[model samples]
Every structure is written in structure tokens, then in C-alpha cells.
Target: MSKVRVAVIGCGSISKHRHIPEYADNSNVELVAFVDPVIERAEEYAAKHGGKAYADYETMLAEVKPDAVSVCTPNYLHAPMSIAAANAGAHVLVEKPMAVTDEEAAAMNEAAAKNGVKLMVGHNQRLMPPHVKAKQILDSGVLGKVLTFRTSFGHPGPDGWSIDGAGSWFFRKNEAIMGAMGDLGVHKSDLIRYLLSDEVSEVAAFIATIDKPGDVDDNANVIVRMKSGAIGSLVASWTYYKGEDNSTVLWCEKGVMKIGTHPEDQVIVELRDGSVEKHKVGEISTNTKQLSSGIVDAFIDSIINDTVPAISGEEGRKSLKVILSAFESQATGQFIKVN
Candidate 1:
């Protein structure tokens, strides 16, 4: 009946670029409180969004009592913040790669369930039109039995991210955990899962920080075997001198599909009969980089209608498990089974 009051736990780039704008722009939502260790950043966002600023999240939770909170903190903070939000009687919308470990992801999921709050992971790519269309085509049986697949996501290093060129948690091993795999690889892993409607059961991977001046892997790739008998490969890099987001290519028995903006652009469906259909999709984002796509709208709708989000916490955990396996596979030099 009333607007959903939302609080954002981090005021960094992601919060500025995606969560703040997304929550502010949604008509059914009210941006109510902001939180950041740096109070100034939180205050700025709060002033812009017509909400209160909070230097401490516990204080905010005790006072504002938001209906939901967006966990925009770093890789290491995601699990703890999400669990806290759920325990504080608020729903959660967490950023990608749910957590660094399957154990953490499971904990977040369990906390949400224990509190009876919905836990949604922001795998924004899945919200893109091209990805949505590709999933439809794959499920339509036009793709026939799946054969092999490849997907990638690459971006230039984060050095050029802010105008100031200041350093951030992205380069910190304690904060980032894994490099490209967590930053971009999870997107492709999640995308393929959504498109193929299957689980990645095993992984063989190579991870290295060949480019970025960080301890974590700025470049990595993995070969995956699906439970459904389809094989897949995931590649991601922050070392690309120049490249767009990325794309996923699937070759089934009857047809093939590609998603993301990097390739020929949008969702391209090519049938074995030599017929090709392409969609020139725009970004899922709006004025700000936050996914303005129908995906978040669907998340909101699911909350309102009491339906399950297609990109639920379980789905997010599945992707995290794959990326974690990728790291383990690289270490052991053996196929790692996903949990």
C-alpha cells in the first residue's frame, strides 16, 4: 500500500552509480536512509535522495527501520551486511557474486529465510533484454539440445574508474577476495546459467593477475561442464585495453544464441537452417548505470505480488559456487565440483 522504504548500506561507486539511483527513481520505493563509514559520502547521497544520513548502520536500523536495504559494500562485507539487514527485518538486494564463498552465500540465504525476507542478488546482466531474449530462445527448443557455450566480460582496469584516479577496495586482496572472477566473471557464469537453465557441475580454470597492478587475478578463464551434459567456458578480464561489457555464445543442435553488447550486439539467434534474427538491445541501465531494465522492476513486482524472483539468492549462490570452484580448480589443477 505504502512505498517501500529503502536504505543503502554503502555510498561508494556502486551505490552512486546503481543502487541510489535505482531506489530513488522507483516510484514504489522511498529512499529513506544512507550508510557509509565515511559519513560525508552517506550524507551526500541522503541529501540527494531526500533521506537521512547514517555513519553507523546499526543506528540507522534502530532508527529508520527501512523495509529493505541494498547491500552495496565490498566483496567481503556483502555476507555480513546482508545477514544483518535480514535480521533487522529488512529485505535485501545484494550486488553480484553474492559472497566470496559458498559458505557465506549459504549463510546469507539462511539469514534471509530465517527473517522471512526476500534476498535478491543484483546480477544485472540477467536483467538485460538481450539476455532475456536469449533465455527465451534457448528454452523455446529452437536451440535444441545444448552442445557447447562460451561467455566473457571484460573491462579496462578500475584505475580510470573515478575522475580522481584514487585507489579503492578493488585492488585490496582483503576486500576484493578474487579479482576478475568476482568482478566480472560471475556475470557470465550467471548469464549462462540463466540462458541454459542448467547447473555448472565442474570447473577447470586458470587465474592470473597479468595486467592490473593488484594481487588478485585481473584475468582468468575457466572450462565448465554442465550437469545437463553441455560444456561451457567463462572468460573475464579487467586488463582489456579496450572492450565493451561482454557476450555469451551458445551453440545448440538447432540454433545458436548470443547475449550482451560486445559481439554483433544484443540477442542474436541463428538457426542451423541459415536463418538469423538479431535484437539491437540497449543497456539495462537508465540515466545512471544502475540497471533500469525491467529486471529490478520485476524484483519490485515480485515483492509486491509475493512471487519468487527469477534471479533469487539461490540463483546468485549457484553462480558464486561456480566462481569459487574456478579459483579452487586453478589451485588444484583438477576439475573442481561445484557445491
Candidate 2:
């Protein structure tokens, strides 16, 4: 079988940790180009993966003309890069948050639809084994009624991920519209939606610069009303010292499920029957990489077999709506409706 040709834009930590290795080692994909503004970085990436590299995404698009591209740039560039890739006749799998704004996300979605191509967002949290299992259990109705969930993702700061600690693009409000919430909080928001098989319709949030001392907020707490009348909460901070975990817990009338530790770990599902089911999955974790690969495989296979990906672009948009509304709620000091 001929593998689908893939070009990866923004050769950064994410692409390096997740997409690059997945593509390079996968038999169904051919990694053809690495795009990065930093020439040496691109070259280094290409060298490591045995693929060509380009300093410009446009140049790579025009030259390699890959079947698909992974837009792994910072928050600001997701829309433009995805739109450009779609225009160039390539399927686009954009990194999370989709875009800083709903307007940008809409434009990118429109562009992909206009080009008649697949447009997928990289919300890899949904692909985690525990999450997948949670969805299955939810669908099976074993949990009875879901009450709420507590989900959070936190770290010391952005020094490890961003190129320049507090001075990086993440710190720049203009370059990146929001901070920790948009970065880490959005993921949890999406996961909650995905796991519960519901949508967040209303959100009331509080955001502050409790740590890192900047205009961008480092910590946030949000109250959300899901479409199913399930009330939920999310808190994410980059200021947490001693490596706090990225964990999600779902509380139902009959049971509860928890994934990850304070900063990171396995998954545990507890049922009302006084039984516990533990599932531990790990393989190059990032933004929940197990879920990342699982969803990637599903997306690629769906394309090849003429099926639908478990998580569609529209599905992703639904999650984004909740995330954006949370931000609006924080800014307005009131509940923001998803509709």
C-alpha cells in the first residue's frame, strides 16, 4: 500500500515528540518535508527523520505538495497554516485550540470545506485509552447519570515547552491571544466534552496572573453547564510547583473515573459496585500522545477506508466553542453561553 505523504510544519516540541516519530515509524504515512523558520532546526529535524526540510511552509507546500500536513505552529499561526495547507490541496491536522479565536477557526474550517479536504484538529486528549474507555462506558450507560467532572493540567511554567521561557510567543498577548487557559485549560475543557458525550453550553470563569506575573493569566477556574445538564469545573495553571499532574475525573451517579496523577500518571475507573478498573497507558505522552496516535490512526484509516473519523472537525469545533466561551466568561465575570 502506498503511504499517505505528510509534511509537518513548525518543527517544535510537539511535532518533535509526537507527530515526527509517529509519521516516521508508521507504515501508512510518508513524511516528506519539515517546515520551520529556523533553517538549522528544520535541517536537524530532516536529518533525524531522513526527510527533506524547508525554512518556509509555502515553499514546502509548493515543492513537496504532500497529501496532508500537520500544522504544529504556535497558537497564532494555526488558522493561516491550516488554510494555506487546504488551499494547496492537502489535508490538515492542526494543533490544539484550533485558533486563538472562533472567527479564525471558522475561517480555517471554511477554507478546508471550500477545498473539499479533510480538516482535523489535534485534540489528542480524546484519544487517551481511559478517555476512549470512558466514552464507551458512558455510551453503555453503566455510569447511570454523570454529575460533574474535575479536570486540570498544570506545570511549573512554559520554560520546557516554549523556546523562550516567559519571553516566548506564549507570553506575548498579541502573538498568543490567551495564556495557560488557552494553552492547558482548553485541553481539559475539550476532554470533558468528549468524555461526557456532551457540549458545554454555559461557562462562568475566573482568570488571574497568580503566577508568572504577566498580562496573560497563569491560573483559571471555570464552571460549565453541559448540554446534558451536567455541571463541571476545570482548573489549569502553569504556576504549580513540583510538577502537578494533568488529570481528569468524571463523577457520575453510579461511579467515577480518574486519569493521570497531579502532573501525569495512569487511569483509574471506580464504580459504585465497589469495584475499581485501572488502565495504564503510556507511549511518548504529549498533550496526551496515546490519544494523539489513536486519533491519528483513526483519522488516517477513515480517509483510506472511506469512513468517518471518531472525532470530526465539527466535533472539534464544538469543544472549541466551550473553550472560547470560558475565556469570554472570565473576561466578562458572567456566564457565557455556547449557543
Candidate 3:
């Protein structure tokens, strides 16, 4: 196919700020449709991006027959919408926290495989320039072995970013399934997995709704043990009122690698021999200052090239399992093994 015909399933903040604009910018993609329950939101995107606006995704899939679909809906709808699009013969690029349950995530993956379509997840943290560089450095054996680490992602909350402000679906448990953990924690989980090239074998956590006016947790402190015996802490909070913090510090045997910790440096490596290497690879996308997440480009390229996506459905499910295990750990007050 010369150009991959694409459709976005939700006209929410993520779709508006990331998918639509990126797809429009890509020369290999043709924006075919936009779907949203709020028809005006869809129409608004359609007007700017040259696509038909539909109130229902099912109808849009049937009518547009898009080659690929970006499932940018609520956390609960991700599996169903992605399954539907796959069944309709469209490749799917779903947002993070791919599904509410493990079964749902598996079902989505099954649907895509059965339909012979690509399934990519928006675990964009792995695609960040700094993260890519960090992975390279880690793989080069320069940091020796990652002994312990701390990764955190915190912001004021999604109220300012969501389309529905304070009453957004992000606050509702039924729609969001989780709050800070699902929103931010999963990203770190995926990043850690990617950087370390290891899976989280177990997790113990404390999850609570400390400050946010929502049923879901506003803060989570999770202790993770990787399969390689590396132990670390993963923190996710929606109560960072002052500013956003998306940083990771890895304590390795040879040296320490800090990512996003310094304002001027993206990755800082301090060796045991007292040498320092600071890398300004590129800007990591932030809540306030948005950048091309690179997810849309990767998804489109996978479709055009008929190759597996970098962040495949299985990868997304694995990262999501860590978050789910963290939730389970909090509920049981024990170290839960990630399956």
C-alpha cells in the first residue's frame, strides 16, 4: 500500500494531541475517519485533518474500512474497540494500560492475530530519545549490572489534559480502571523492562487515594523484583502539584545512570572511577510541553512494512501485568508474582 489509510477511534486529549496530529504529519498515512461519542469533537478533527467524523466506531469501521485504527478511547473500551477494528481487518495502535484485565488484553491480541493485523500499543516511553539512548548504554555493558533503581512519573493530574476537565473519565473507576498507576506507573514499568531487558518477576505495593477526589488511587509506591534479581521502586502519583517529574535513576555495579533527573542533561552516567558522561539526546515528551511521541510513526511504519511493532500487544500486556500485580500486591499485602 502506498499510504496506510488510518482512523482514530476517540477524539480525546490523547487522540487530539498525539495520534491525529502525528498521523496527519506522516506522509505514509491517510487520515480516513475520526470517531467519538461527542460528535462535535470528531467533527472538529475531521474539519482540520480531512476525514469523515462518525459518532460510533463500529459505523466508522464499516464505512471507512480503514487500513489501520488508533484506539484512543477510555481504558475500558480499548480491548473491545481494538478487537472490533482488527476483526474488520484494520491494524490497531492502542493507548497504554491496553486493557482493564489480563483476559481482555489477551483477547485483543488474539483478535489481531486471528485477523492477520498488526497490534501496537502506545507505550511511548520506550520510544523516547533519552530512553533509547539509555537502553543502548545499558546494552553496551558500560553500567555493568543494574543493581537497584527508582523510577517515578508524577504530575498534578489529568484534569488539565483531559477533554472533560475535572469530570473526566480519568477520575471514574469504571472508565479508568486505575488512576496514577494505570496512567503513569505502567509507562515506567514498560520503560524499566525495555531498558533492563528483563521482566518484573514480583511486585509489592501500597496504593491509596491520597489527594485526588476520585475512587481510584492517586498515589502508588511499588517495589519490583526483576527476573534477573534486580530490585527497585516504582512510584506513580497524581499529586505532584508543583511540577511534573518523570525521572529514573539506576544504581549499577560500575556506575549510576540517571535519566531525566537533570534539567540540562537527559542521561547522566557517573562511573565508579569518578568520570561523568552527560547526554542530551533529545527532549522527553512532558504533559505541559507535548512533543511527537514517535508512537504514531512506529505504528504506521509497521503497517507499511508489514513488520511487528516495537511495542507489540504482548509487550504491552507484560507491562500492564506488572501494574496489575502491583494492585494485587497492595490488596493482599504480599509480594505478588507477575504472570
Between the candidate structures 1 and 3, which one is better when assessed by TM-score?
3
Instruction: State how far residue 70 of model 1 sits from its true place (Å).
Output: 0.2
Q: lDDT per residue, candidate 1, 213-293, as tens digits?
A: 769889898998999989988999887776555767888898877666444457777898999888776644422244564
Q: Which residue runs does candidate 3 get wrong by more than 4 Å?
A: none
Relative to the true structure, candidate 1 reaches a TM of 0.94
- Cα deviation at 115, candidate 3, in Å, is 0.5
What's the TM for model 2? 0.91
Would you list the rank order by lDDT, best first?
A: 3, 1, 2
lDDT of each: 0.82, 0.78, 0.94
RMSD of 3: 0.7
Per-residue lDDT over 109-192 for candidate 2, one digit per residue giving the tens place of the 0 to 100 score: 789789987888777777766667667877788777889888888877676666555567777777777888878887788888
Structure candidate 2, residue pairs in collision: 127-291, 128-291, 244-262, 244-263, 245-262, 245-263, 246-263
The pairs that clash in candidate 3 are: none
lDDT of 3 by residue, 132-156 (tens): 9999999999889999999999999
lDDT of 1 at 327: 89
The per-candidate count of clashes, in order, stands at 0, 7, 0
